[model samples]
Target: MHSRKPFYLLVALLFISGLAASIYRGIEHNVPFLPGKQVQSWAVDAKVRFQATGEPAEVSFSLPEDPAYEVLVENATSPGYGLSITSDEEGRRAIWSIRQARGQQDLYYKVTLIPTGVKQILATEEPATPEPYSWPATEQAAAEQAIEEVWSRSATNLSFAQQLNKALTASERSQNIELLLSSNRPAQLFVRMLNSKGIPAQAVSGLFLEDQRRRQQLVTFVEVYHDGQWHLFNPVDGSQGRPDNLLIWDRSGKSTLDVIGGINSQVNFSMLQDTRSALATSIDVMMNNDALDFSLYQLPLEEQSLFKGILLIPIGVLMVVFLRVIIGIKTSGTFMPVLIALAFIQTTLLTGLIGFLLIVAFGLTIRSYLSKLNLLLISRISAVIIVVIGIIGLFTLLSYKFGLSEGLTITFFPMIILAWTIERMSILWEEEGAKEVFVQGGGSLFVATLAYLAMSASWVQHWVFNFLGIHLVILAMVLLMGQYTGYKLLELRRFKPLAGE
Candidate 1:
């Protein structure tokens, strides 16, 4: 029992060290996703300088056409005169100026570049053409042409297809559509049919009314330009296709009365397209932002490999503590049983347990039989060692003969530990009784099995891996265990009669 104090002290120290290390890692050692071979952009203000000796150098500056209006070029010269200009990319520039220099004097110019916004556009499509058309009539004509084009390409004359396609193609110059079908949402069928004929169409997933209750449904909508307005089509029930129900809200954010298309007929209308409200668009933006944020910190090289397993050691230690201090299990060689259990983690609990039990059982039987020969203690252990080797050799031969390569790996099962355990158990059997030896051996195995289970639990793995700080939870557990002075559960069972008095 006095020896047990050192074990408890060792456990306490380990707990404190683990707690400190985890906290240090959480605060000081951040495992960030460091930027690799990827391009990153930032907006900055810098001064531009140019020099021309005998002849003036022709310098031209350009900026990305955006809403912020921050691009400014200070100095520009043709033949020793300063010039300034402001225009858009289609027009001229926000601000461009020129400075004149003759003899090798450096001209100082400042440019302020501001970021308006960044958009990730698919590379599959070419840049949109910037062409303006007359309002009202132009918009009406374009809408009609787009609808006609879509109708001509579509295989189904269903009212839903006609209305949806017409709306989708209305703003051909501004809108691009890709069609996809999803079995989960039948409404996508209409979208796919329209897209098959070269109409830009896609299935939209959102909540729609079904049977008077608000429920999730996929709606097929199309982009349309009408009356100088770009709108998304919301077609009501018709021979083509119609959703069971629809909800509407005006531009003022007021909810409009629910539109319940008659079983036979539905309303045909268009809505303004807001990419911000699109689920897919929003998800893509979030993923990209998170990816970029992660690509900023560097993690340790050595930790990169062992990080996962190292995080799980706390649970393994907890299992060891629970077995020793709570369940009152006996094990030979402090932590050797847990280490064996860790080896089992590599092979898996069921197979490892079975293999270990079989090997130890066979080795113990050989050791017991040799004990009848009156061999010396060391000689008896050595004889058991030889028998264990022979058993491993036999197992390997049988595994190879039967094409069970898995069994061959168990041949490497820490033969020395097996020999030592058998020798110890034999001593216990002789000095105390077979029951005492069996109880202790069984207790060690029980501890190992518990350790195995704790290490393999998914939630345990996830929490330990994601939030290293949570290791303090394990530390707290150890601290609580340290103060536990009550008899262990097994000891309570043994002392029950005394307590009953």
Candidate 2:
């Protein structure tokens, strides 16, 4: 039992494992299983428009990164502007320079993003405590009182930062906080006071992403180090964390855009929402993996497009196997239906069937006449091919003349296969009568039509192209069909007479 069953059992197990792994990976990467769950992506534009004087100009702008989203591409307009992009320990920037400029000018930076919903660990540098700020005598007394008030009530560095932040924002702030914040920015004062308590903190800005945002601006917040990690806090409400929609733009709390010869420089962001296929998004995951160097997505664009069509052949093969083996359908050749189904892909099903029948009928008639000539096999086959080609050419030209464009696709039918089919049917008719010829010929067309429907389905095409492992499952199905020794649906008709007995 073990020896006989092990082979098929192993095949089934491997097929199941491969199918499960493919589906698991697909779901893990957010590939949609059904039609309704469209993949979501975002396109963001950072427009920097400014005015230039009749002098040399230098403009610098800070860039943003969303730790939870994948950045696909970055495009910037640098017409007439000397553009230089560099990132250092401080942060990244885009600097645009020119020799001479005047009047209104515009520059744009755009980025495409796909939300992976995966959090990225920020590469943080050594945390440094901010240097204490100088204060005038009057301000010094108020600052000392404010720090002492919250520090006395706090238990740890984190609580001290939280408490100090609360006091600065409280409706009734102590005299020191009132003086300090009135003279300095709220986030700026928060960082200074946090370091006064020996805690490292940085003022940062985050962008809130939304659909159709016209002129978005950055919101500044403070990041405090606690337990070996940096945590976000709201500057206005002094909340404990950032929002889900927030994208950290600047951690240095420095200027985002800079211009020497340009003035009134400002940055406005626009956002657009896009719904993409889940399979397309899965390709994005593969594109990021270094191990997938040989994936279809890594191929040249032309090859990738070609494989998109080639991959669906397996689906056609599966359909043919089901129709032939499991359903007991008769066909002209073993795999001829599969090839016909492939041709049906380019030429639509209705037109393909009509063209197939018309060509075969006429070719058979001509084949009958040639059969009486006693020609050799090779000569007769060649003659049939020439006749098939001539018939196709005539149909194409007439269709074009009459504006019946659908007939143009008749060229997609395989000339050699049609010729061979016609020759086979003519010989079968001469020996086995017209009835058997029609039965097998109709069955082939029927199976090919079903294969065409299955192969041309959008989801089948997408899945076959996106997940290559699905072929193992298809192979397993064919193997199972091969083992079917029972009566087919068509053969069940014989049992109808037994039921009466």
Question: Which candidate tops lDDT?
Answer: 2
Q: Give the CA lDDT, 0 to 100, for residue 203 in model 2.
A: 82
How many clashing pairs does model 2 include? 2
Tens digits of per-residue lDDT for model 1, 32-93? 22212122122222222333443433333332232222232233323444445445323332
Segments in model 1 whose C-alpha atoms lie over 4 Å from true places: 1-311, 369-387, 470-472, 498-501
Residues 286-364 of candidate 2: C-alpha lDDT, one tens digit per residue: 6665535656777889998889888888788888878877788888887788889988998899999988998998899
Estimate the TM-score of every prediction. 0.42, 0.83
Per-candidate total of colliding backbone pairs: 16, 2
Full-model lDDT for every candidate:
0.50, 0.81
